[model samples]
Target: MAVCLQLTTSNSSMCLCQTFTTHLFLPILYSAMFLTGLAGNVLSLWIFMAKISGKSPTHIYLINLGISNLLLCITMPFIAVYYALGTSWSSRSLMCRLAINVLTPVLHTNIGVGMIILAWLALSRCATLVQHSHGPRPSKCIKILPKVFFSRLRQTPFALGVCMGTWAIVATASIPSVVVYSMKETEVVEDGDKQTCYSVAVEVGGSGSQAFAVIGIVIFFLCLLVVLCAYMAVIRHFYRSRKSTVISDRQRVYARVFRNIVVIQIVLVVCLLPYHIYKAIFINLAQTDSGGNGTECHSLSTYVEIKNVLLCLAALRCSTDPIMYFLLDKTFKKHTLNLIRGRSNTQDSHSSRTECGQSAPYNNSSPKGAATHDTHSHSKD
Candidate 1:
């Protein structure tokens, strides 16, 4: 859900960038995210692993996503501490080493992994919604759509494999760049500076690191495109299946799915897109203008500060993810409410299928079911 924030470099005389955002803003924002994201992710993970009975493909993917969110939350305090202390730590200290070696890698790994997970989740949802559609009998084109995207995305085993694969791929993509930057480059900073985290060595990285960053930007856009297309396809499918003269449980199911698509896409666009887009531009600028090299704080001017601000926005996803899960997943909502109401939901957990439904529960529902928010609105695929 969130990210690593670097302080502005120490050459304020060369540029107009504020010197205090790392001190005044990052610590506060990361602290708020830590408190909120930690509680939300812990609760979500519990519900997904323990409370939900029918572990649909969506729930399986969500479990992995929750793990990423939790990891990001775990890194927040160290980031907050680094910023609040004015971004200074003894270069030889344990905290400084951990910040450089552990925190940076973990934060980045989870951010890439989170984006990949979201893309897969969107595709899975699209597949399941189409597979379970029951409004009007689907046309020939509708019948073939699931196969084109992924027919087995709804299967728990396949979904698990896909999630594991996502983590492996994203983690692999992130490691080389981080290793090059953190090890080969970071130690070459000025001798007397107190900088440990935010320095030319840390920000600029090796020239080869730029190539890897380009790879990352390409991957990010591809994933974003997948999310947009799959969610849009589901929305279009719902439209084609509905009739003007009659409204059925199928239509209601379609309506709910549409609302979900809107919410999920909005979250992706708002939280993640800007950073990836700007990262591409930053890389382009750094490469084309040799005089304005990333290796010098004076040359970079305000670019590094802008980069950190956008990264902070991307990290805001951590807090928003749990809220999104609660709003989007029916099974998640039910368990959370039971906990809030002080009711033991052990009985319900075993009896009901998760929101990622396996049954055609929506097919036979009464039209009046739309008026009530019962768990029986024909659950999604």
Candidate 2:
């Protein structure tokens, strides 16, 4: 009888552990991710608009990436609140389904788009650097790619069509998950207590759904791998061509930007790889019906924990992106500083004017000086 009671207690404990890991711990992890990501992406968006606007194709891509990250972050708080209140989702079924569906595509597309942009940036660097060394002024090549891409990007209808096409691809890739996984209510009975609530779950689709999920995962991984390879090649080529020195500040800035891109790519890989791998394993286990046993339960718990950790790492990307901008884009840093100083000077001038009944002369020597003076006076008003 004592042995029987012990066995029963152990089983209950295991169930509780699994529930807590999935419902409580994972929610908290996602909450942190949401807050961090939202703050970071919003900042990136602002910086892009206010500081980096109309600069380069890379900047345009970065703006899009920021928007995607922001959208994902917005959904995370809902997920966190759902899990925090109880291990159950209290939200409406439709909302749960929409939330889950929206996140997958946003995440998948953001990663893909970001990687593609990085690859383009690297390839552009390689081409421009190679040409500059072989022929006319190196600086001329910097303007050439931007002139070409920007001209193409400027046709409003064409730009819209391109955006639509890219989004269509992402939507197509994500539709399978939306169709196969949806919100459903499940009943949980612990001891004599019973509760029912809605939660996200995979729908009853045979092998087809499983295969589709795998394919989506594979596509993302392939894109990541390709980006990694391209950056590695770029770095190697740069290293080999030591004779082609970065003579000017502009060249130096470009070199630094390339380095930052490499760093960002590395960070993305480190954070995202573990989550995908664990998710792949979890899906495999679920498909095989191997998750019902004790060993599999423990494995699931560990994977959940690992996923939480990865999510935290992924959140770093949002905050880290601003740092990359600061490092890579000297113009952004200068503009930021000018804005700050302009505000400070304006405040000082306002105080002086209030005390002495006279306004300061507007300095219009340099373009930045004129801009700063105007900004300062505007702030005072």
Candidate 3:
């Protein structure tokens, strides 16, 4: 009878938790995240393609990053809907598994690729600075590394290769979870009066899953550290340089880009830390067989709630990325202005000619011949 009472209480608590999460928190959080991520990522994609498409090699990498984030954001609505419908996978089991599995790899690859690209951009800028300090001429050795790596990168189709490689890694990592956790039909009975179908089951985490999660966390932290280091180097370089060099338009633009990147990195670290810590702790707790269930269960519940909130914050990164691109990239702004203006090449040329005509006389005429030369110079010049 005592065991039965304990089981009943556990069930009640779980039901209450589920109701609170599904009805109250999940709907609001998921909807907001989905909409924000979708709008941000889509805008980022448009801005990159429309404005920064032909700017530089570095912009190519950034455009790809935006594309990856856009793809990930597109998946958010499905996730939101699933949670909003009481955490039940109403979609086909295959889709649920595939979506979950794909999401992990896409996220992992996106961060990895973004960090790698950002590092290259920083390194490229640093190399340019060093070369400029030396002289206008670039040494043969200085040119070799970029030529070799970029040539190789160009030869290999990066987008297709990255997509395939990422999917493979994610699929391989998710295999254990797929095998260990089979969807089981569960009926929640409330007050002996209400019943609803839900998918629930026990998932046994194997060495592989644990290892994958650990490696992912390590990759994330390593990238964060590298980016921080690179930013510090950049800051130092800016400060040490002459004020005139630092205040140039090019330098200012790069500074804004660096600032945005730093903000994004900080957000990434803050949002991901709680999730990683919770995962580590929860995994350890699950492996222990202590029958002191109540305390463990409560702790798990709290961690889960915290994890959900952190996940929402992490999702916000997708939406904010586009805004960063818009704010930081002057080329994007110029392109947008051009598109809005929709002036033809002919019209631009005509305007240029008119402005030149207005200024030509003032430039050509001497003080004594000002009036007389003005009329003649306008026709001749």
lDDT of 1 by residue, 1-381 (tens): 112233334542222123566566888899999999999999989987987655667777888989999999999998888656523555556776777778878887888888888888787766655555544555343565656446676578887998899888877777787778667766644445444455445555557777887888888899999888877777777787675426565567668767777887788898889988888888876666543335323465467667777888898898898898778766678778878988756556544543334333233254333223222321221
Query: Ten consecutive residues with minimal summed lDDT in candidate 3?
Result: 1-10
**lDDT values for all models:** 0.69, 0.48, 0.47
Better of 1 and 3 by lDDT: 1
TM-score of each: 0.82, 0.64, 0.63
Which segments of candidate 1 are over 4 A away from where they belong? 1-18, 90-92, 134-149, 189-196, 288-297, 345-381
lDDT of 1: 0.69
Model 3 residue 287 CA deviation in Å: 3.4
* Model 1 pairs whose backbones collide: 1-317, 1-318, 2-315, 128-381, 362-378
- Sort by TM-score, best first: 1, 2, 3
Please identify which of the two predictions, 1 or 2, would achieve the higher lDDT against the true structure.
1
TM-score of 2: 0.64
Better of 2 and 3 by TM-score: 2
Using lDDT as the measure, the top candidate is 1
Per residue, candidate 3 scores C-alpha lDDT tens digits across 204-321 of 2345555656666676566566656655654555444424343354454345545655665565577655666666665666456333445313223344455555656656666666
Instruction: Name model 2 segments beyond 4 Å from true.
Output: 1-29, 90-164, 183-208, 244-258, 294-299, 337-381
